[model samples]
Target chain A: MPTDKEHVHNRIAVLRAERGVSRRDLATALGVHYQTIGYLERGEYSPSLHLALRIAAYFEVPVEVVFSLTPFPRLGSTT
Target chain B: MKGTTMEPTSRKQKAEALREESRRRAAERQQRRDEIIRATIDQEVAPRWASRAGRRRLVGLAAGLLALPWAAVVVCWYLAPSDTAMWATFALCLAAALGFTLIANPLMKVTRGVAGAPDRLLDERQITERLRAQALAHRATLALLVAASILVSTAVPDEGNVATLPSAVFAVFAIALLATVAALPMLIAAWRMPDPLPDDED
Candidate 1:
């Protein structure tokens, strides 16, 4: 089973692409480094709920649409 | 009357000055920590996620290593025939296990303390990054320990029919396992702790 760290799956890149937003633009909007945006998109780092909400807001989407706790799944319990 | 009033006023002024100085020193110390946190955060960003994973992996490795000596002791006790070789193997395994436990236990404690320092309250990113970096360092240490065990076991000859080689191999593995697994949860917990928001928010 994946650990808690892996629970928050981010679809940052997909959202950014869907919106035709460049990494620089997103980084600027988020007030973070562009590399941070890249890292977030790649799932190398998990964002805090605040950051997740911010990202979702930036993309004008629901937080769940941009992030999920479903794919990694909890260690136990089905569905 | 005027002279008596001036004396009290001067004493009050002195007390205020001392209080101000104490507050100033506290502010300076806080500023220093803020700078350190800033630097640590900047340095930690790229490597944070990788480090947490590393800590978990390392702890697991250490735990696995810890199992080796017991296995060796049991095997040696059963064989009974090769007394000299068994004793030597047992001693070596014990030493390795003890050495690893000693080093890893303290190392984990130190890391936890550093990660949990209240002075680190800064940007949330900074705290997260520091934790992640610590985890990565821990993982790297575990990897090194595993490699070292394999190397050392290979160097030791298998000439004696006393099961020395297996014991040594298992000892290394156990130590690595113990070190890795023991430190994993703590590292994760430290990493997962929420960073305090900026003072203005409070």
Candidate 2:
């Protein structure tokens, strides 16, 4: 279920965890504040298109892989 | 013979002491970083929504602030009944406005991202939230002022005292401006907070 009207869900936390990057470290890379990263991960705020693309570029992932309008599937789920 | 061996042992002891100092410094640095992280988490993990009590307190403070200038004006009108007294009331209200700017502005900048103070850089989300809140508050203030003006015009018959009327009007506008400035940021910030995250939910 999408919490915000923006409807832009993301895998930012998962990717950052997989890469062993701290929020501060990733925020530095993305040229944003650490709290901004927290807001994005928690769905409390949605990033601009420019920021979303920049974040995707930072993680070296396709925009679709990073964000979606629908809920992401749980890892290892049968569905 | 003992002296020669003692020299090498002394060198080893010096090296060991240096290593211990280096390790201690590293531990201290790590501890400092941990403290910073803890503080950041404390700030960021606060309850998103303001409590009922918090709202009441803020409204009370705002009301008190709004009352001050009017109270001064009334006192000046009754006690002195001179142009000088009116001027004094204006000065007092101006001082109150200045005090609010000095004390409340920084607080708002830090907590609510108000005033767009550069030192405390607000993220886009905070900036947007404040803008939305201020716009609503501004409209409300404008409407209230218009209604107030109409009521005052109807109630207070024109005595053709140009000097007194203009000053009174000026004082009213100044007080209104100060009240709006003092109340808007706090109201917006208080209203924008979200509920805390439950342990089971995000």
Candidate 3:
């Protein structure tokens, strides 16, 4: 049912890939365990908004650019 | 241009693979924990509409049952004045029985709801917090019961009347004494134990 947390964040992996950063380096930058970085990148856990923003900031991009709401619903014409 | 690939020894490759597998497992465990927490919160805080529907059904059932006794009490009161105490006692007993039944019913449901749930939700930190709070509450209740019992025993004389003091007072004393004594072992065990799982299975 998507229980809120399932609106996954692909941001970590996307940012890491773009910057060509290793998981260990990202973990060090994030001040979290390396496994945490791996978990974040795999979308196993959704980061809090604060963590999301921090990740986006680390990538030098807007939060929207880094994180996205997936299975994007189409905007219909207003009735 | 293709470069020559260097193959690593089996032992080194095996070690590297094992480390990667361990990291993967850790990540998976953390993810599972997060998912379980999210699900629990959702269940606990189900939509207001759903909760309201359930409450309405329960209330309807209760009201239907209560109507019969209420009607009987009103009729009996008008027809027979002498049976007031009998009816009152009957009502009180019914209420006590219902209260006890209701109390016991929810324990099983709550246990089922958190069945197979991860112990991380009730981690060592949370267990310690709960034990501390419970200890304080138990002490406070024990103190109150003791004071009440002493006051009742002193104020009310052991004259011809047996039911001079409130039955509730005696019941509270008995319950508190038993609870306090029973809790001693649990408190001691909890204090002595190191990082016990909140649930038995965990």
Per-model TM-score versus the true fold: 0.35, 0.62, 0.28
Question: Where does candidate 3 chain B have its weakest 10-residue lDDT segment?
Answer: B193-202
Steric clash pairs (candidate 2): B48-B193, B48-B194, B49-B194
**Model 3, total clashes:** 0
C-alpha positional error of residue A42 in candidate 3 after TM-score superposition, expressed in Å: 25
Q: Which CAPRI quality tier does the interface of model 1 achieve? A: incorrect
Candidate rank order under DockQ: 2, 1, 3
Docking class of 3: incorrect
Worst 10 residues of 1 chain B by lDDT: B193-202
Q: Which should have the higher DockQ, number 2 or number 3?
A: 2
- Output DockQ, candidate 3: 0.03
- Candidate 2 lDDT, tens digit per residue, A1-79? 1356657888999999898888878877876656668778888778888889998999998999998988899999988
| Residue range B59-81, candidate 1, lDDT tens digits | 45555555555455445434544
**B64-149 per-residue lDDT for model 3 (tens digits):** 43343434433343444345645653564466447434522222122222222344544232334345545765775578568856
Q: Between prediction 1 and prediction 3, which has the larger DockQ?
A: 1
What lDDT tens digits, residue by residue, belong to model 3 across residues A4-23? 54766466665676678877
Judged by lDDT relative to the true structure, which candidate is superior, 1 or 2? 2
